[model samples]
Target: MLLEFVVEVPAEQVRSEVEKAYTVLQRTARVRGYRPGKAPRNILSHLYGGRVHADVAQRLVDATLNKALAEQSVQPLSQPAIAPAELRPDASFSYKARFEVRPEISGVKWEGFEVKRPSVKASDEMVDAEIAGLRRKHATLQSPDPERPAKVGDVATITFKLEIGGEFLDQKEQEVETELGSGHLFKEIDEALIGMNAGEHKDVRLTFPAQHQNPELRSKEGVFHVTLKDLRERIYPEVDDEFAKDCGEESLEALRASQRAKVEKELTQKASDAVAEQLVMEICKANPIPVPPSLVDQQAQLAERELLAAARRQGQRLDSNADLRARVRLDSEMKVRAGLLMAEIAKEKEVKVTEADIEKGYEELAEQSGKNVAKVKAEYRDPKKRELLIGMILEDKILDMIEAAAKITDAA
Candidate 1:
C-alpha cells in the first residue's frame, strides 16, 4: 500500500513559477542603493535566489500534486512525504512523493467456510456464583468481638515501628490496615498477627525482600514493634426477600430469575462471538493479503491509548515503550487486514446503508445511553462521527450476510 511517485514538472512551468516568485519579491524587497521595485533582476536574484527557488518549489507541488494523482487515478490515505529538492531555472523540478494508499485487492474467497459455534451454556451454578458476587458487593464490614483474636479472612488495623540495620524507616510509627494471612505487609508479619488479640503488642523479625520498591529496605534484616489495634469481619446479607429488595428486585425468586436470564444472555452472546471469530479467521486464512502499514500503525496507536487510559483509571503507570508496541503489532496487522477484506467483500455484495439504517442506529444509541433520540442525533451531527456510525452499520450488514451463509457447527 506504500507507493513512491517520481514527479517531474516541465522546465517551462518551473521557470513560470520562479518568475512569479521573483516578480512579487522584487516589488517588495528592500535594496541598499535602489528604491523598492527598481532593482535589477540579476541584483535581486543574487540576494534572494535561494529563498525564491524554495518558494517556487513548494508552490509547484501544491499546484500540481492533485493533477498528478488525478492522472493515475490514485487516492492517497496519508499525507505525502515530499522529498527534498530545489527548483532550478530552465530545468525540470523533480521530486519524490511517498504515501500510503488502499491496497488493490484482486479477489476474495469468503463463502461456505466451515466454522464452529462453541457449545457454551449457562448453568445453575453460574447463577448462584453471580448471586454470591452480588452479596459480596453489598456486604458490610463489622467489628469483631473484643475477646476474639485476629484470624485469617479478618481485616486487622495496627501500628508498627520498623527498624532495619539500626536505622528507622519511618520517623514515627506508621498505621496500616491489612488482612490477616494475606501477606499484604510481609509473610512474617501476617503470620505473627494470626493469634494476637486487639490491644496486644508483639515483636516480629523479617528479612526485607530484594525486590521491594524502596531501596532502603531491600534485603535487610528488620524488626517491627507491632500492636494489633482492631479487627473487622466482612458480613454478607442472606439471599432473602429483604436482600432482594435491597438489590432492586421484587423478591428472592424474582432475583434468581433476573440473574438466570442475564447469565443465559451473556452465554449466548459469547457463543455468537466465537462463531464470528471463527468465520473471520477462516476467511483471512483462505485469502491472505498484505495490510497497509499506516492502517496498522493507526490501530496500534488506538490500542496503546486505550491501555494507557485503563492504567490511569487503575492508578498505575504504563509507558508506551518499544516492548508494548511490539506486543500489539501483530494483532494490529491482523485487525487491519480483516477490516480491509471485509470492506472489499461488502463492496462485492453491493451492501449499502440506507437512511432507515441511520435512524435505527440513532435509536439504538439512545436506547443504550438512556438519552432522547433528538440528543443522540445531535451528537452525531459531526460528519466524522456520522461517518463512523455509517461504517459500523455497513460492517454489521456485511457480517450478517457472511454469518448467515457460514457453515456453523457446535464444538464438541
Candidate 2:
C-alpha cells in the first residue's frame, strides 16, 4: 500500500504547521497547580515534556496525509499506513500514506443491446373459461351416502386424537375438520388418516415425510388415535339462471357480461406483466455484465425479509435452515440479475425519474392499495425512502421503454 503524491507547502506555512502542534500542546497539557491553557508555555513544556510533543506529532501526520490524499484525488479503500519524518516541534512536517484503491473500469461498450416483448390479448374463450371457474367457486355441496372409503373430491369429517411419543398431540377437541383433500391437516400427524372410514377408530402411526411443507415437522414421526366421524361426497349445483341470480346478477347473460369484463381486465394486467418480464429477460440475456457481489447480497437480504414477513402474515414459520438458504440464493440471484440488466438499460438510454412521474406512480400504487393518493404520497415524504421508491418506478419505466422498442408477436 504505497500512495505516491506531489506535496507542496509554502515556506511561510511551514512555521504555521509547527505552531498548530504548539497550540494543541498548550490547550491539552496538564501541569501541577496550573490551569491548562492559562499556564505559561515554558512551564507547560517543562511539566508535560515530550508526551505533548508526541501528541502534536501524531496530529500533524494525520492532517498532512489527509491533505495530500485530497490534493492528489486518491481514494483509499482502507486507512492509510503513514510514516512520518522525524519529529520536530518548530519545523515543517511531511509524510506519506500507503493504501489500496478501487480500480477504475473503462472501455465497456454500451450500445446495440436488444430485448423482446411478448404480445398477448384476451380472447372470448378465455373469458368464458374464467366465468366457468367463478361458477365452480359458488357451487353448493350436498352430503351423499357414505358407503365407500373417502377419496379425492370427497369431503370427510373425522375426530382424531394425535400423539407423538405417547404424548397426546391433539389438545383441541374440535380437531379434525373437513379434509379438502388428502393430508390437509395443519400438522401432518400421519397419512394413515387418508381413506379411513366413518365411526372407525384406528391407532395410526406414520413418519413425517422429508418433503413436508411445514419445516418444523419434517422427518418426525407421530401417532394418532383417529376416529372417522362422518364422510360425504361433494355435489356441485347446476350453473343455471337460478345460480346466476344467486350471484347478484339479474340474468345469466348479465353475469357472463360482468365476468367477461373482470376477466378482460385481469388478462390485460397479465399481458402487461408478461411484456415487462419478456423485455427485461431478453435485455439481461443479450447484455451480460458482472454484477456487483455487494448488490447481489443486499438484494438477497431484502428478498429474505420480504419472504419472512409474508410467512408471518400467514402465521407460518420458516424453521429449516436449508429451505431458508435455498430461497435466499434463488431470490438474490434473480434480483441481482434484474437489477444489473435494468441498470445497464438506464445507463444506455439515460433514463431518469421525474417528480411528476413519481406522483403518477404514487397514484397508481394508491389505487392498487385502496388508499388515498395524497396519503400514499405523505407516507413516502422521507427524501431517501422516496428516492428508493422513485428508483423502482424508474426501473419499471426502463422496462417499458425496452418493451416499446421490441417487435412483439401475439402468443395467445
Best candidate, lDDT: 1
**What is the C-alpha RMSD, rounded to one decimal, of candidate 1?**
4.3
- Model 2 CA lDDT for position 408: 68
What is each predicted model's overall lDDT from 0 to 1?
0.87, 0.67
Q: What global local distance difference test value does model 2 have?
A: 0.67
lDDT of 1 at 380: 100
Q: On residues 118-225, what C-alpha lDDT tens digit does candidate 1 reach at each position?
A: 756667899899999999889988887546877898888999998878878788989999877765678889989998889999989998877555687779899999
Question: Which residue pairs collide, candidate 2?
Answer: none
